[model samples]
Target chain A: MKTETKAVDIDRDKGDFAYPEVHVRDAGRGLSEKTIHYISDVKEDPDWVREFRLRGLKTFLEKPLPTHWASKDLEAIDFDKIRYYLSPGTGAKRSWEEVPDDIKRTFERLGIPEQERKFLAGVEAQFDSEAVYSNIKKAVGEQGVIFVGSTEGLKNHPEIFRKWFGKVIPIGDNKFSALNSAVFSGGSFIYVPPGVKVKHPLQAYFRINAESFGQFERTLIIADEGSEVTYMEGCTAPKFETVALHSAVVELVALKGAKLQYITVQNWSSNVFNLVTKRGLAHEDAEIKWIDCNIGSRLTMKYPGVVLKGRKSRGEVLSIALANNGQHQDTGAKMIHAADETTSNIISKSISIGTGRATYRGLVHVPKHLKHCKNNTECDALLINATSRTDTYPAITVRGTGNSVQHEASVSQVSAEQIFYMQQRGLTEAQAMSLSVNGFVNDLVRQFPMEYSVELKRLIELEMEGSVG
Target chain B: MNELRVENLHVAIGDQQIVRGLSLAVPRGEVHAVMGPNGSGKSTLAKVMAGHPDYHVTKGKITMDSEDLLALEPDDRARKGLFLAFQYPSEVPGVTIANFLRAALQSRLPEGEEMEATEYYAKLYEKMELLGMDRSFTSRAVNEGFSGGEKKRTEILQLAMLEPKYAVLDETDSGLDIDALKTVAHGVNSLRGSKIGILLITHYQRILNYIVPDHVHVMVQGRIVRSGGKELALELEERGYDWARAGADEPVLTR
Candidate 1:
C-alpha cells in the first residue's frame, strides 16, 4: 500500500524561480587591486579573512585557467572585464521589510516575500555580495534553529564553523572552489538543534544583477543528532551580453540519526558560468538527500554529494537537467560509503534540445571492508534533436566484496511510433514530445518539493518549445 | 457511413515487401478480426497504420471516414481519430498512465480549451473499474514492467479512454492467459458501439471466442485471400493456413 499525500503541487511559484527583474547600472569600473582591497576593507572582516582573500587573490592570478572539461566555457569568462563586486543594498536586514526599494522590487518580482510569508520557516535573500534580508519565523526561531548568512555564521560561530569549513572540500579542491574560498561573500548558515524536526523548509535566493561580476556565496547546514531539515538554494543571473561568474560552496552535515536535504534550482542566463561545489557528510544512521535541477546557464558544473561516515546511513541524489541551445549542464551527484551497511541510489535524467548538451558526471565509491553495502545508479538521456548530444560518465568504484552495485546508462531517441501514438490521440508532435519528455523524468521530478516540482515541469515545457516545430 | 479502409495496401521495409496489397474495411460499429500466420504483416500492418515511420507505404492508401490517413503525419492521422493498440507496448519510463492519458485527451480538445481535472479523474476511475484495473495503476508508468495481461489490458484501457473513430489492435491477445484474455476481451467488447470501429489482428483463434467478429479474414504472405464468417477462424484454427494458401495458389494458364 502506498501513502499518497496530495496537496496542490503545480504552478510551483508561477513567477518564483524566474530571474529577478533586476535593473543594473553597468555604468561602473572594472576589477582592480584597489577595488579588491576596498572590498576587503569594506566588510571589516577579521585579519585572517583578509589575509586569506589576499592569498586566494594571488592564487587566482597565478593559477592557469581550467583546461580539462568545459574549457570553451571557461575561456568565455573574462576576469579583467568583470566588476568583481556590487552593493545593491548596504547591510543585512533583521526583517525583509527593511530591505531597500529596488531590491525589494526585485524579490517582489521573484515571489520571495510571498513565498517566505506563506510556506518557508525562514528566508534569505542575497543581493550582490551579502545577504540583505534574513528572518526566521517565530515558531522556527523558538525551536532554536540557526538560520543566517554564512558570513554571519563565520563571524559569530567561528569555533563551530572553522572546524568544518574547507574540511570536506579544501581550498584547492579545484580551480573554482579555491576562487570561491578566496572571495566568497554571502550564502546561508543553518543549524537544527538536537531532536528538533523543522517541518517547514528554509530557502535562500542568490541574484547576480551586475554585468561582468562574480557572485561567490557559501552555504553550510549542520543538522544535529536526531534532527531534520530541508534547505533550498536558488540562483538567477541577469541576462547580460558579457559573461558573469557564480561559484558557490555548500556543505551539509547530518549527524547521528539526523536527516538533511539540500535542494537547488539554478536558472542563470546563457551568459553565466555556474561552477559550484556542494557536499554533505552523513554520520551513523543519518540520511542525506540532494535534489538538484539545472535549467539555464551557459555552462554549469556542480555535483552535490554525500559521505556516509557512519554505519547504516543512506544517501540519494535525484536530478533533472534540461539543456537548451547554448547551454551545457554538466551536473550530477557523488556518494562515498566510508562506513558499513550504507545504501545509495542515484537517478539522473537529462533532456538535450537544439545544440545543447547535457552530461551526467557522477561518482559512487564504496571503500574496502564495507560489508552489505548497496549502490544503484540509473542515468537516462533523451536527445530531442539530431544535433543535440548527451553523455553519462558514472564512476562506480566498489573496492570490497559482499557489496552489490548496479549501473545502467542509456541514450536514445524518441520512438517514432510513440510519438505517432500520442499524436493520434490528438496531441501535436510537439505536445507528444513534451509528454514523452515529461514522462522521461517523472520519477525524478516527483521527488522535488511539490511547489518546486510544478515549476520544474513548466520550465521543461518552455525549454522544449519550438524544438519539434 | 464512415469507414477505416485499406485499399490494396502494400508495405515494405528496405527491399522486402512485408505487406502485399492487402485490402480490408471496418465500418463504424463493427469489429473485424484478421487472423494470420506468425508474421504475415499482422504487427507490421498495425504499425504502418499507426504511422510507425519504419516501413514505406509503397503502394497503399489508408483512409478513415473518407480522410486520406496516409497523406497526414502519423500524429496528425491519430488526432483525426485513428488509434493503434500496439502488440508490444513500449514501456515509457517515468510517465504515469494517468498523465499520458491526460495529455492524449487534452490534445483532443479545441485550442485554448482546458480539461477539468476532477471530472477527468472520475471518468478515468469509472473506466478503470470497467477494465478491472486497480486505481493505483494510474500512477504507474505506462506499460513499464507490466505483466502480459496487464500490458494488453492497458492497451484496451487506452482504447476506451481515447475513444478513437477506429482502432487497429495488433496481436492484443498474444501473451495473455485465458483469464486475462477474457478480461481484456470483455473490455474490448464493452467498448464496441456506433462511434468506434475496431480492426482486430491476431495470430491465434483463441481471442476471437471472447470478441466475436462480424467478419473474419485470413492473411498469408501479407495478403488477405479469404473472407468469411466466424466459421473460417475455426477452419484456419483446425486445418491451418497452408491448406488455405494451397487452395488459392493454383497455377493459372501462362498469361
Candidate 2:
C-alpha cells in the first residue's frame, strides 16, 4: 500500500474545461487516441509513460482479441465506443486532506478508513483513475518500508523501481499487460527491506466512477531477503448498461527468505469486463501467496502466477469466484517449479447462479532436472440454477522422475433436502439459496481479511437474491 | 383456535401411499406423543406435514388455529405458526447461528421493517440462557460440527426463540444421551403453555420419561391405531408396540 502524496497538476488545456454539470455525465462518449493523449497530458506523465500509452494503443488496435478460450459474449466489447479515461476531480490529491468529500464518502460507505483503523497498518484510497488519499502508520514507514503508487515510485525511487519494472512481467506478456504498462495510472508499490518483518497488513482501494471508461493501473512489490509483507487490493465499479474495462498488471518479487501475500476482492458490477495479469517471482526459501475473491463482473479473466526460481521456495494460490446472470468468471492460478525442493498448492472454488458460468484454467509444470519438487491443485464448483455451468481445465506436465503432481476437481449443486431444511427454519427461498452459496465458498473466504470478507459476503448475497424463482 | 388439526390425511411418495386415511389433533398447551417403529412411515409423516415437496398430500388438510397451513410453502408454514424440527438437520457451513437466526427472524417482519440490533441480541441471549447454551454457540455454524446432543439442543433453542403456535419434534430424542434428553426436555417444557401446542414423534418412550405427555397415540403402518392419556405410554413401553399392531385387527371403541 502506498501512502505518498499524489501530485495533482492538470494540464492547462484539460483544466480549462469547466466542471460539466451532472447531466452531462451521459452526454459524450467514444474511444480515441486523443482520449489516451488527454489522459497522459493531464497526469503530466514522463515521455516513456506517454510512449507506452501510444504503443499500447497501437497493440490494442492491431491485436485481434483471443476468443478461442473465452465466451462469445466477450466479443461484444466495442473498442471504439468506450471512453478510455475520466480524471476524478481536476487531478489526484497529494495529501489526505486534499481529497474531496464526495470521494471520501464512497470510501467511508465501503468502510475503507474503518478497515485501516481496525486491521491494516497502511491504506490507500483511489477514486476513479487516481489515488485520492494515502496514509501509512509512522512506524511502518520508519522501518524503511517504501510504499507508493507505481508512478510515484518510478519517479522518486529509481534505484528500487528501475531494476524490476517489467522484468517479471514483460510488456508483451499479454495484450492487457501491455495496455496496463503503457497507460497505467494508480496502484501500490511496496518494497520491504531485508531482515524486517512487518506484522500488520497494507491495503489499497480502487473505485471506478466514469461510465464506459477503462481503468488501467500498474502495481509492483519487491520483498528483500528475510522480510515479510502482505498487500491487499479491493475494487468496485458502478453498475452501468454498457460494459466498462478494468485491465491491471501486478508484479511481485520475493527475494531469498522473504514472503509476500497479495489479496484482492473484486466486486465490479456485472457491466464491467475485468481482465487482469498478476505474477510473482520467488527466490531461495521465499514464499508468495495469492488470495483472491471475484464476485461481480460481465466477464473476468485472471490467473495469478508464481515462478519458484530458487531452492526450497514455496507458493500458494487460494481463489473463490461467484457468477450470476450475464456474467462469466474465468479465473485460476499458475505455478512453475524450477528449483529443487520447491512446492506449490492451488485451491480454487466458484459458485454459478442463474445462467452464469465459471471456468477454471490452471497449469503446473516441473522440468526433469528439478528433483524433489511437488505441486497439488484442487478445484470445486457449485451450481445454483440448473442452467448454470462450470468447466475445469488443468494442464500439468511433470518431466522430473522425482517430481510429484496431484489434481482434483468436482462440480455439484444444492440438494433439495438442504434447501428444505433451511426453509423449514423460517428462511425464505432466496435466503436459503444465499446461505448455501455462501457456505459453498467458505473455506476460501476465511483466508480473506475480515473487512474484505464481510464485504464479499454481502456482495454475494446481493447477487444471489434475484437468481431464484 | 389453539390446535394443530389434520383431517383425512392422505400422503404419497410418488405413486405409492405412505400415510393413508389418518387424522389426529393436539390441542394447544399440551404435549402429545406419537410413537411408531422404523419403516412405519414415521419420518415420512413428519416431512410431509412440513410441506416437503417429495411427498404429495393427495387427500389431506392441515391447519393451525383455523388457518390453512397446507396451502403455504415450507418456510411460509414456519413463519405462519408451524415448526418442524428435522430428524437430521442439514449442516450449514460458514453461516453463523446469529446471522442465520437473524435472517429467519427478519423474514417475519413487515415489509421495510428492520429489526433493532440490541433488542434482537437481547432476545436471542434470553433464549440461549433458557436452553443452557454457551455464549459462543451463537457464532458457530448452524448444526455443522455439532454433536448429536448439541444438534438436538440447538433445535430446541430455535423452537424457543421462534415461539411457534405448534412444533413437531421429529425424533428429537433419537440420538440424545440422558443428559441431552433432559436438557432438550427442559427447553421444550419451558415453552409449553396455552399459546403453543406440541406433537412429539419418536420410536421410543424414553423421551416421555422427561417430557411427560398429556396424551399418547399409537401409530402403526401409516395410521394412528389408538389414543389415550399419559398412562398409555407407560403401558406401551412395558407391553411393546407389537401388541398395538396386533390390536388393529379388533376395534376398541372408547370415548
Best by DockQ: 2
lDDT of 1 by residue, A24-93 (tens): 3231345545655766666667777777767666666777777665446688777777655554332122
Error of 2 at A68 (Å): 3.5
Model 2 agreement with the true structure over A1-469: per-residue lDDT tens digits: 2234434322211101111112212213554577667777777777776776787767766666778766677688776676555543322224444433433443454455443321111112223323322335355778998877666788878788879988888877877787676567777778899998988777664222211123677889999999999987764322222227788899999999999999987776566788899999999999999998887777999999999998999999999988887679999999989899999999999999888899999989798888999999999999999899999989898995888899999998887888898899788888898888887787788888876777666667666767787
Query: Would you estimate the TM-scores of all the predictions?
Result: 0.83, 0.82
Estimate every model's Cα lDDT from 0 to 1. Answer: 0.76, 0.78
Which residue pairs show collisions in model 1?
Answer: A424-B78
Residues B126-241, candidate 2, lDDT per residue (tens digit)? 98998789989999988889999989988888888788888999999988888888889999988888988899999998999889999888888778877899899888888998
In angstroms, how far off is A95's CA in candidate 1?
26
The single-chain TM-score for chain B of candidate 2 is 0.95
Which prediction has the highest TM-score against the true structure? Answer: 1
Judged by whole-model lDDT over C-alpha atoms, candidate 2 comes out at 0.78
lDDT of model 1 at position A54: 71
TM-score of chain A of 1: 0.81
